[model samples]
Target chain A: MSQQETVLFDAQGPKARRRTMIGTVIGALFLLALAVVVVLRLAGQNQFSMELWGPLLNPGNENFELVWGVIGEGIVNTIKAALVAMTLSVVIGTLIAVARLSLGRYARIPLIGFVEVFRGLPVVVLVYLSVRALPDVGIDLRGWPGGQVFWGLIIGLTAYNMVIFAEVVRAGVASLPRGQREAALATGLTNGQAMRLILLPQAFRVMLPAIISQLVVVLKDTSLVVFVANFDELLSQGESIIRNLGNPIQTFTVIALLYIAINYTLGRLAQWVQARQARGSTAKATGGDDLVPVRDGA
Target chain B: MSPVIENLDLYVDGFLTSLSIIVVAMIGSLLLGTLIAAFRVSPVPPLRAFGTFWVSTFRNTPLSVVLFFCAFGLPELGINRTFYFFGVLGLILYTSAFVCEAIRSGINSVSAGQAEAARSIGLNFSQSLRFVVLPQALRTVVPPLGSVIIAMFKNSAVVGAFGVGGDLWSTGQTLTSARGYETLPIFIGVAIGFLLITLPAGAVLQVIERKVAIAR
Candidate 1:
């Protein structure tokens, strides 16, 4: 009985079991108290009143129409910015990752510096700088699709996500058994052909989950554009709605839920990809599971 | 002093503000994260369920949403506070989820035999975890924990956008607006400031990780 599978803790004796019951009761009570306090505080502030939440529920309200319209636009813009940035980052990241792996010191050293600098710097700073600096450099993107803010936000997202994707690609390539690349070269394939034909395909297959997870990170990070670039993405749009409607609680809650829904779906997609990859390959690639999204500050 | 040199104080002040927020949030997240990790690995089902719920909820939601909720929404809920308080609280709430995952992974790395042995010797759940499992688990998790901390430091820049004054990013904004067209130098300065902190911290953590690493 004692040697039975006890992954967490051993089966408890009567006395230990009683102690656990008491502890659970106390913990439950504490949580209940905390919830009560929060509710009371919010109620005291009139946050629960119909006035605060009416606009969200009332379809005929002009404010409701405006808020929803802005949020819809914000969603489109967020997706647009994220897709453009993700595409640019993946392409640039692949190039840099390959260069870093194949090239000598002159090429690799500068690339390494670029990755490190951008990775360390906050995304918000990069976006802010791009918004201000790009125009000064005569690359005004104001005449483009979503205008200056859109391009600034995309550039910023690219700068940070590119470095991350580069790391992912490098890890993917490095994780492949050396024999895979060597066998291609031994078959009279050029170095480029060997890499393109044999190595990169396997690397991409192994790294797809991580790459998709990074796309989710990029999507969430589009919110940061609101801060520096004056972009009316989902969060900023929510902010504007709150300002006009004076229902910060309701507006922010909806925005948070929307973000969670999108990011949660993306997260689940990443997990599903990971599961499929595991089933497809007998030789498990290391380091792909560790590719959790790192922080992207708003 | 040139404008860049003359604006050293702004950068210094910003650095200090960022450092303070990072320090506070790091400690807060570590404590909260460890508690959540304990819940996650507890023998009880409800504790584990609560821990999983917490991790999924916070982990899936965007940090900006969390920050905005704390900074703006809380004030409307009669919890008015300084921007620093709300920002730090938001950061701690969000980053703690990642930290909890890191710690949980650390906890998982400890051999099952260790815990079973401790139970056989009459050590209870908390005691066994404290005396046997956690020490080994924490050592293995140092590198991942370092990355989480660095992420927290970078994420602190988000506070700057929400009228949270006295951070490096905010200072850069001030400098840029004041200097008008000279945005490049100010931003470059800001980037250097961030690297100065993150690079050294990463290097130090690597050294610590190497030192404490257990041979498999």
Candidate 2:
């Protein structure tokens, strides 16, 4: 008797394809329905006006330039915040990751606790707390006259990113072959020396993709600062425009497009980095699965 | 005012409001996010493309932008733009993108072998996914999804700026606008409420994470 060969259905088989078709059909219908309702409501209210669209579309008027300028400021603010946050998150995250992996329970426990607490907290709450706490501590971020809100947001963002980056950092370090450490010890290098010269650099390179992905996250997170800070980002700027123009749908659509542009660009960048890393690792490929998502359930 | 003592009632009220919005938004965003995630990972190319587009658009766009669109912009379109509805919608949409990515990543983590085994045993597509695949994927996704939920709870505070009623942040703003009360107490109270909820959640996720580690 001959045994029948069984192929993997989990690897995008015919059945999964059928489910995908059904799901897509249902999802498309739902989204189409929602979009139609929104459009009908706008059309009914006469919000789809030529007058509103004309000014925003032309960009010829002085007011249009001013709005564009405000938008420019928002762009600058968003980039600035994301860059600063990303740098801080990487540096602080590295320190925390090291601490968590320390041999001493004293070093390990506190850092682990810190990571969990911040990782668990909502970004908004941290921002609110920062707003209330920073001024009381007598250290004001004067450049942003918006006061507590800006600092609160920055600090909160840093705290959470620290938690996320730390784990990725730690995991990268932990995954290094134990033989490397043994080889380093055999070469007469101290624990710290081996880590600094051998382990840390490799771990950082290995973890760079994950770190960059977090940068995208930090960029997206910058928009959350709009409500708390008087300083306007893309979302805030869009809101202000809609308020002036009274055309929420168009303004929102514009905002969504801007977000899509920036985030999509970042996503592409992350993909590029991943591809490059994959190519680099191909020569030295082993059993390691670097791209696996962290598990949630036991 | 006696520092903390004089503002006890106000603090309690503010805490309650923050807690309520966080809870509601967390649940709503999770359910919405999971569905979107399922769509994104669906096998159909167009469906996958659409899901990817939706997630990317929402994830890339700031939550406040989404909220403002719903709040002020919707009103312009004669949608009434109530605080509750707008806030919930914004959170769900914004968080759903992240949730989808997390869930898809989780689903991807499961080896194709498990699904193959289910199929070899004569299980159908939905049946294999429901029984064998999703169970494994859920385990991997739950902790990260929990973090996303906590993040949603925090982001709901933005709706306060739109003058959304009932939320803790809004209630604090209402109090401040009416009385010349120092902004400190109200914000502190709100922050405390968030801490109370998030702190425990963080611990719970840690526990889940450990269990996952052990299981693997």
Candidate 3:
């Protein structure tokens, strides 16, 4: 059978088209069903009253002051925690990844094990453990007024982000050809010199997307700290508002939208970086495969 | 200090609950993920789009939002308090989205020639997918899927936010608040328990990956 004949004869033709049409129809119906259920439930509870949204949306409403105040504070705390954690995690992750990729087996084994365990543990558990233990060792983390919850949050976020960044960096480094390192060594570069000058820079470019992605993960994971430190990140702030309003639907919906905004912005930033790199590569005369030197050793 | 016998039992009970949730959710996510993966790779454009939307939405949205929406938001809409059930349901839905993408990527990694060969031998699309594509894809996917499962188990801690009647973190919270025993030991215990579950699975996944590489 010819290529054209196969294309025509295979069910990838009309059947696929028909299935697509059906799938769209079903999707529309599903969304409609969901909307109807939501509307009906709201109607039964009279939650659809314009009164609630009015105050919430109104710039001048008194509750708006508290709501936005809490949100603003939460935003500040979230950013602080995420920034601290991101810095710590990246630094620690680099060290750990280096340790894992080290020539010594004994060193590699423990580092690898630590990464696995930390990555596998939940953020809440880490936060809880940190908060519970730090004070007992005379650290008195929580006793310093506002500093207690901040430290706990930082520790928890760092623990998980460390693992993620380690994996990302390791994979990035491994993707580099061994010859790059070998070339560096041929120039009389030391092991550390080769890694820093030849490998780490290139690895970072490759791992840029993964690192950006882990940032979002770390951001959301910050919410789990409410379990331990009880600090008011966006989620906790929303929860507190809901506790006062006795309306989980509206408050949580607001919170969800806020998260979507933050996460979506970061996602777009990552895509932009990726696209720039893609265009840069394509624009250059080196073509695809000939670009980016790969070293098989270093 | 010697471990307290009574506290040990409580910890064991918490571990059991956590383990059961993890097991059930893992199975559910795998099945859900597979079906979604199939849909995603279908020749049908709409199916592919729908699958993409599902995965992207779940992946981007916070797991806490999903848990809270199901547990609290649904109940407001006449879904009664089936906390335990809904808790697992939410986790499965969230985790499966990630799993589906991983599986889809694995499927795409398989050479197109293999599928063509399977079809040339008179196998249908489903048969080719099952015998030729899936087996290969699954072998490549085990390591990532193991990571996803482990992540899901860790994420179930979010279910504690639902004020669920029982679970490890919730029980720990209850005990800590009531007994005022140092929350440190219990927290450490839970972390260790979580590590115990995921580390072995991760090791097994690596072993399998190595075996597959050797076989190849």
Candidate 4:
């Protein structure tokens, strides 16, 4: 805003400065008053009492470690699902992208259909389908070491995100000059070999920031697994702790903060990389900015 | 087939709920988002900070969490409301951030000369923005705005899942989990329910994009 001042309003004179000063104070007071009202309301409900908050966060509380231990397990399960899904989505999405690009028209058409359908639906529906529908087909995930919920979550996340990543990869490749593909083909390389040796590497570099940021979306989407057949991810664990300790507000606040902390860090990492890549091409060319809506479940 | 037919009324009711959700939240977010975008670009430092804080907090938090907070946290503060009200509020709060960023970036993309020319012509900031810059910026904004709104449409699914009961995902889940209906057919119905909302929306947005596209 400092640098872009010319667009909105010019520098303020003394009277105008006084007006803005009063505006700022009023704004601050308004926000502060809202906070006070919330605090007062919570206080009336005895929400600030130590008994409500102790078991989960207070170190001296005997149940603190026990509660956190369960949450720690939930964190592990969430990370495990996120990591496995992220790895699979990236690898399979790249292969599918290459295949979609290099394949004949007949093959590409259905691939487009598959991508479109999976991309369009909410991921929880897919997760629910894998959990329930697959079992009827004798593809039971129960015997898997991670349990049905974990596998269900992974499969759904992978299906939705792989298509998104495929488009991202394709967009990256398309952003390059046409000569890169032609030059590789001119050197007597097969199409697959040319894409493998030439195009994909450059595309990945150009797509690094978007790919990293998509991981944040992947991590956030893991929250959807909270309802996937009692998976005990971060959210459900928060629910259980609340049931035991009788504090829905504090427990969910901690859980929300945990998600924000991890996601905010990853979001920052993507921005740092984007900043480094700022000079190369516009972020639009990547088509996978942090704001891109390929995110599953929210 | 039997299960879907049996629950046909529930499907209609739930989907209708979702449709209303899209309409209500779309308008809510757009109006709120425009205000925040204006706040972000304004010369006031406090307003800019407030805008930044709001965007970062919502954008970083997961939608499920936001909805969860609404479902649970608001009640704790004695802010009682219907599940439907809370769900819509959460959607508007979470989505307005994305809309703000899209508009802000659109505002930024408008060439500096336009604002300068507006000022020279004696139009003030809001006047220039309303008359000249925003109209141009909105043209560039439509495509991304479309994506954001579609994303919001899809996210209404979370509203149903998070205890705001009357939407397609929950309707399907109740049929399958409680009533012991067939999962495959119910899931298919739910997917179609979502597609019924999203596909037409996507087509409409594409049409709007073509109509409003600027050469620059």
- Using TM-score as the measure, the top candidate is 4
DockQ for every prediction shown: 0.51, 0.42, 0.43, 0.59
Return the lDDT, model 1, position A168: 82
TM-score, predicted candidate 1 vs. hidden true structure: 0.92
Give the B-chain TM-score of model 3.
0.88
Q: Give lDDT tens digits, candidate 4, residues A1-298.
A: 7655666667789988999888888888887898899999989989888888888668999998999999999888788888999999999999889989989989799998888777778777777677668888778888989888788888888987898889888888887778888999999999889899998988887788788778888887888766566887888788889888878888888888888888888878887876777665564454335333333225
- Give the lowest summed-lDDT range of ten residues in model 1 chain A: A1-10
Model 2 TM-score on chain A: 0.81
User: How many residue pairs clash in all the candidates, one count each?
Assistant: 0, 2, 13, 0
Quote model 1's TM-score for chain B. 0.91
The residue pairs that clash in candidate 2, if any, are A296-B140, A297-B139
Lowest summed-lDDT stretch of 10 residues in model 2 chain B? B1-10
For model 4, which pairs clash? none
Identify the runs in model 2 with alpha carbons over 4 angstroms from their true place.
A1-34, A100-103, A129-133, A143-153, A282-298, B1-6, B43-46, B76-78, B160-162, B171-186, B208-216
On residues B1-216, what C-alpha lDDT tens digit does candidate 3 reach at each position? 223245777767777887888889889999999988867766545566678778777776678777877887777778886788888888888888888977875776576677778888999867877787778877866666666776787787777645554667776777667877666765666677667777787778778778775243
lDDT of 2: 0.69
TM-score of chain B of each: 0.91, 0.87, 0.88, 0.94
**Residue by residue across A1-298, what tens digits does model 1's lDDT show?**
1221254566678987888888787767777787798888888887888788878777877677877899998888888888999999988998889889889878689888888888888887788778778898789899988788888888888988888888888888888898888899899999889878888888888888877777777888898877775787888888888888888888888887787788788878888988987787778755456554333322
User: Cα lDDT for residue B35, model 4?
Assistant: 90
Candidate 2 docking band: acceptable
Runs in model 1 with CA error above 4 Å? A1-6, A60-62, A105-107, A285-287, A290-298, B44-46, B111-114, B117-132, B179-181
By lDDT, highest first, what's the ranking? Answer: 4, 1, 3, 2
Interface CA RMSD of each prediction in angstroms: 4.1, 6.9, 7.6, 2.2
Q: Kindly list the per-residue Cα lDDT of model 3 for residues A1-298, writing each as its tens digit.
A: 1321232125456767787688778866876787798899878987766556644577877688888788788777777778788889999988888778764977578777777788777777787777667777677775654588778778777877787777777777777777889999999999899988888888787666566766777777777766565787887888888888776777777777777778778867876776676576643222222211111000
Which digits, one per residue and each the tens of the lDDT, describe model 1 over residues B1-216?
A: 265578898889999998998899999999999999878766555676688878887877778788878877677557888988998999999899889988877777777888888888999777987898878888978877888888888888886666778888888778777666278887788888889888888789889989999886
The C-alpha local distance difference test score for the whole of candidate 4 amounts to 0.82
